[model samples]
Every structure is written in structure tokens, then in C-alpha cells.
Target: MIKRKFFMTFIVFFFLFPLQIAAETIEEPDVSSEAAILMDAKSGQVIYGKNEFVRMNPASITKIATAIYAIENGVLSDQVVVSEQATKVEGTTVYLEPGEIVSLEKLIIGMVVNSGNDAAIAIAEHIDGSLTNFEKNFNVYLQDYIGVSSTHFENPHGLYGENHYTTAYDMARITQHAMENEIFRSIFKIQEYEWDGESWDTTIVNHHRLVLGEFPYDAEITGGKNGFVSQSGFTLVTTATKGDLDLIAVTMKTNLKNEPYAETLSLFDYGFNNFKTEVIPKGSKFTVDNEEFVAEDDLIYTVNIHDKVSNKINPSGVLSIYNGENEQIASFNLKSLSAPVTKNITDENEENWQANGFLGTMELAILGVSAIIVVLVIQKLRKRA
Candidate 1:
């Protein structure tokens, strides 16, 4: 009985030890938002997520997508003729009058810096000729080019449209894609912009509290957008950099205005404390069964700061990365430096070759010897004749 009790205790300890170690390696942050995600901007890896895939209203953060799309598709110097419908857009505005001619560049500044619904409409109409066409084309662009599937925008500005919904993960991805554009990055990080519009002429400050240093946070606040509506609660998208890590945090559907900001700070802390990004430099070579493969471009990935990471490369030039817990965290397709050798053999023959092993080698040796003997016999017979 004593031995049996000791054995059971040992089994329990053995089973539970690994679970405890894994839990201690990386700690999750306490977040109040309904949907939130923390992503490595460089690698596009989600270090932490909570209900990130659940669709929710994005509010005015939709401007990030709109600004990037317009910058890429439209000429900045083109003068846009504001329509009556654009002037009538509700929510925030640059106070454009009907028949006002605004440069596309200035409109983008107003829309991004001031969160102007009027400028959003004007830019949308200028790019696509109508709000309806802008909505359709913009959704397609988000899905196809930005590679976000769970996002759909009914308006260029995020209003209370029933169909204007996006997931936290999708918002993070959209922000990541937008931050890659130099023009978008410059505009996104602006703390204040001088507005010289037809109806309004004043300095427009960024609405994000952290970007303006309204909140106490340690990391460098790079860029951010904030939004609110009756249906969507408070939504925030923030990008920050600390050390070698660049992070994007998105929080949506918080009841209190300060809740999303607090949660964003919590997420940034979690990412900066527990995770890190590493790059496999371009032209890095990997070997699989004597075949060589190379990373055609720089491959970036994130991992828990306290965990060991291992990489596995297959013959097809696919690299899979795993953390200490043996969980696969990321994967990349590599360029083949050399073609893998192919063997033409049936399953039965392959199985026989494996199973016979030394016996198969012995058989080949015997056959070779027999052939040699036959040749020698023929030569001796010819000489005798």
C-alpha cells in the first residue's frame, strides 16, 4: 500500500509539472475590452488575442484603411470638388462647404488628423465618383490587397451603419499593412495638423490620448486612432515601439472611453515584457537531408521571451517554427537552393528495400559476382575453342 501510494504521487507530480512550467513561462494580460489583439507589426504574429475574431463595430478607426487606400490610389495634388452630400456628412468634419475645392492631400490630412467624416466622404467620392462605389471597391481592396477577411465597411467613415463591422484581428492586420506605407506612417503619427479648409481654419489635434501623451505609458507611442459610437462603444488602435519590438494593439467594444486605452497599455506591456521579434536575415540557408534552401527575403517571427524556439525545414522548402511547448508559432515558405532528388519506386519495392536492408545489399553483391563468373566462363571457353 505504501509503495502504491508513492507511485500514484509520483505520477501526479510527473503529469502536472510540465503544465505548471508552461503557465509560468508567459503570462496573459488582464483586458476589459470585448475584443482585443496584440500583433508584432514586423512579423504579423499575434502574440496575444482575446475574442479577436469576433466581429464588432470599428467606429472611426476605419479611417486608417480609407487613408491608406486613398494614398495608394489617388493623386495627392488633385483638387477634389466637394459635393453637397459630402458637406452633409454627420459626426466630425473639416467643415467643407458645398462646391469647395480641396486638394486630396489636405483632405487626407483633415480626415486622418481630425477624424473628419466630411473629408472621408469627399475623398471617397473623389476616388470612386460616389459613396456607393467607394464602399464596394474599398471592401474589395480590404479583402484582396490588405488581406483582411472579417472586415466590411459600409461607409468611408465609420458611422453607425449596420454592416460596418470588423474584428480586432482584422483591424490589427489593416493597421500593420497601412504602417508600411511611408506617407500613411507620416500622417498617422502627426500630433497636430494646421487645418486651412473652406469653412474651418484651426489646428486639429490627434484624438488618441496616448499619442498626445495624455496617458502615462513608458513605451514610445508611434501612431494611433480612437473612435466611439453608441453601437460600438470605445475602439482604439495603437502602434508602439520598444527596444527591437514594434507592436500593434487593437481593442474594441469597451463600455468606458478610458477602458480601451488602459487595455491597450496593458497589451503593450504584455507584448514588450513577454515577447520579442527576431529576423532570419535574407539569404539565410537551411538544410534538409543534404538539400539546401534559402530565405529569399528577410523572415521575421515573434516568440515568447522565456521560451526556447526550434525550427524545422522540410524538403519542399517550408520552414515551421515551434516554441518551448512544441506549439507551432509561425511558418514560412523558403526558396529552394537545390532540387530534392526523386526516386522512382513503388511502395512495395520501397518497403522491401527498407525491410531487406543488409540482405538487399548482399543480394546485389551476389548477382554481380554471378555475372562476373558467367563472363569469365565465356572467355575461358573461347580460349579453349
Candidate 2:
């Protein structure tokens, strides 16, 4: 009886415990969105997504593209003269009167924080001398930098138009590009923004609920942009971070009241509570025994990561060893680094270099001998191993 009990306990510990890996259950947020997606901004890993590739009107999310083009071409501190067309832009406005002088920085605040359609138009007109030319620049930037294939911009305001559309996946991709720039990032997170004594307040406080207080979830929402129109419904592009996992969520055509925001919160809860980021180091000097490895002052590798994985998940990364000509020599498990690794020969690592040199020479010698033996045997038996 004692033996049987012990055996049963062992079975449970080894078999059941291993299989008890946490799973990320995506609760379809109580939303009526036509398209949605959750992705890691850094790794571009999709956590939870629905109709991610379907294209639809982007609403005010168009400002993300507008902002990107402005950052690249002009300075934020530069003064802009509001044009008649910009002042007359329909819908949301920063109330810029014609010929009113404003800095490009204030316009960005209005564009992102206020979602001011007039500010977007003013900046667009200032950048390209006309809205039509600015839109041409936005489309080119979207194609080249943001990598949104299905996205097309008919206007900068994101007002309902014939061809103004983007997929959830494409919008997420656009957010990824926008987040990489510091100026664009800083403006997105500002809860309250002031522009020439006119302040634009957020309609729904904490566009990303996790970043604010008293939510059903906990996370560091880096920053985000929100959008809405009668045609596009409620739309959002939000960024959240927990541990090493940073994610971007996009929702389009959802209920304006609480559905999109609540859904995003739930998805983040699932992601952080159940999943963890797995950092798989591509190359380890200790394992590979290559003296030449990590010789570059600025080292970079082709890093591939599997993200939003269960805490118990231990995915074996695919590592292919190569030669000078990019020929595949061998493949094996890659060892991960627990801390930042310093590559190159240093005074402290003299012993490591000696050991690495010995190992490298022995490996080469073994290969040479094996090749010679195979060649000799081929002559003797007319066959070789």
C-alpha cells in the first residue's frame, strides 16, 4: 500500500505537473468590432487577433501616419501658418483661426491628444504645402516604412471617405513604426494636452485602462492613439507592457461606450497573468567555442522569438551554425544568457581565450583528419563513410 501510494504521487508530480502549463485563453471581449488584434510591439508577435487582416476605415487613426510624415520631414518647434482650408476643416478642430501662428509641436498635441482633425490638416498642409501633396507623402511612407499593404489614405483627417482604410494588422504595424520614434511616443501618452490656451481633454480617460488606476488588470500601458467616426465606429491603437512583453492592440468598428476599452483590458489580463516572454539567445560564446564570435564592437544577430507563451513553456529555439559564405554547417540548441554578455578579447577573459583557442584548434584538426581518412578509404574500398 505504501509503495502504491508513492508510485501514484510520482506519476502525478512528473506527468501531471509537466502538462499543467498555463494557457492564454482569449476571451472574446464583449465587443462588436469587425476587426481586432493584439500584438507585441517589439517582436511583432500576435497575442490575440480577430479579422486582423480585413481592411476598413481607420477613422482618426489616420493621424498616426500624418504624425510619422511630419516627424521625418519637419521640426516640431517650427512655426506653422494655419491655412483657410485647415481652419475650415470639418469636424474636430483645434480652433486654429486662419493665419494663426502655432508651433509644429502644439499641432502634434492637438493631432494626437485631441484627435483634432483641423490640426491634422494644418500640419499636413504645412508639411507638403497642400493636403493633396501631404497625403501622397503619407501613402508613400505607409508603403515603405510601416509595411501596411492593405492601407490607403484618402485624407489626413480620417473622416469617412471612399478609399481611406486599414486592416487591424496593418494598423498595428503602423503603430509599431510610430512607437519607435521618441516624439511620436511622447505625445500619445499625454492624458492632458494644452495648445495655445485651448486644452483637449480625453473623452474616455485612460485610453489603455491598464496604465491608469483601479482596473481589473495591471500593466504598464506605454502609450496609444484612439479613433472614432460614425462609419468606422470606435477604434483604438494601444500599447501595453508587462515584464519583457510589450504588446500593441488594435480594434475597429466596436461600440463607442466601453466595449473596445474593456475588451483590450481583458486581453491584457490574459496575456500578463498566463503568459511570459521567452528570450532565446541566438548565440552563446561558452557553447559554440568560437573565438571569432562576438568580435564585433556592436554585435547583432538574426533574433527570432516565440512570445506570449505559457510560463511553463520551454521552446527550443532553432539555431543554425554557419560559415563565412553563409553555408549551413550544423544546427543545435542555443544557450541563453542570464545577463548582458561582453564579446571580444579582454584582459579578464585571457584564460577563456586560451581555452577557446585550444577547443577551436582541436575541432578543426578532427575535421581535417576525418576528411583525410574518408579520402583514403574511398581509394581502398571504392566507398566511404
Please write out the lDDT profile of model 2 over residues 1-385, one tens digit for every residue. 9999999999888664442322212244544578888776765666677899888998988888788778878898999988778877788777778887889988887777777788898888888888788778889888987777999998887999988988999988888888888988887787765445333333423333434433544677777777788888888887888877777888899756567777777767656654454443544333232312222122222111211112111233334533223444334443444344766668559878899999999999999999999989888886542
What is each predicted model's overall lDDT from 0 to 1? Answer: 0.91, 0.70
Off by over 4 Å in 2: 1-17, 20-31, 197-217, 281-385
In angstroms, give how far residue 38 of model 2 lies from its true place: 0.9
Model 2 residue 139 CA deviation in Å? 1.1
lDDT of 1 by residue, 150-230 (tens): 999999889988899999999999999999999999998899988877777889999999999998788899999999898
Query: Candidate 1: misplaced stretches above 4 Å?
Result: 1-25, 339-385
- TM-score for every candidate vs. truth? 0.83, 0.68
Best by TM-score: 1
For model 1 the local lDDT of residue 113 reads 82
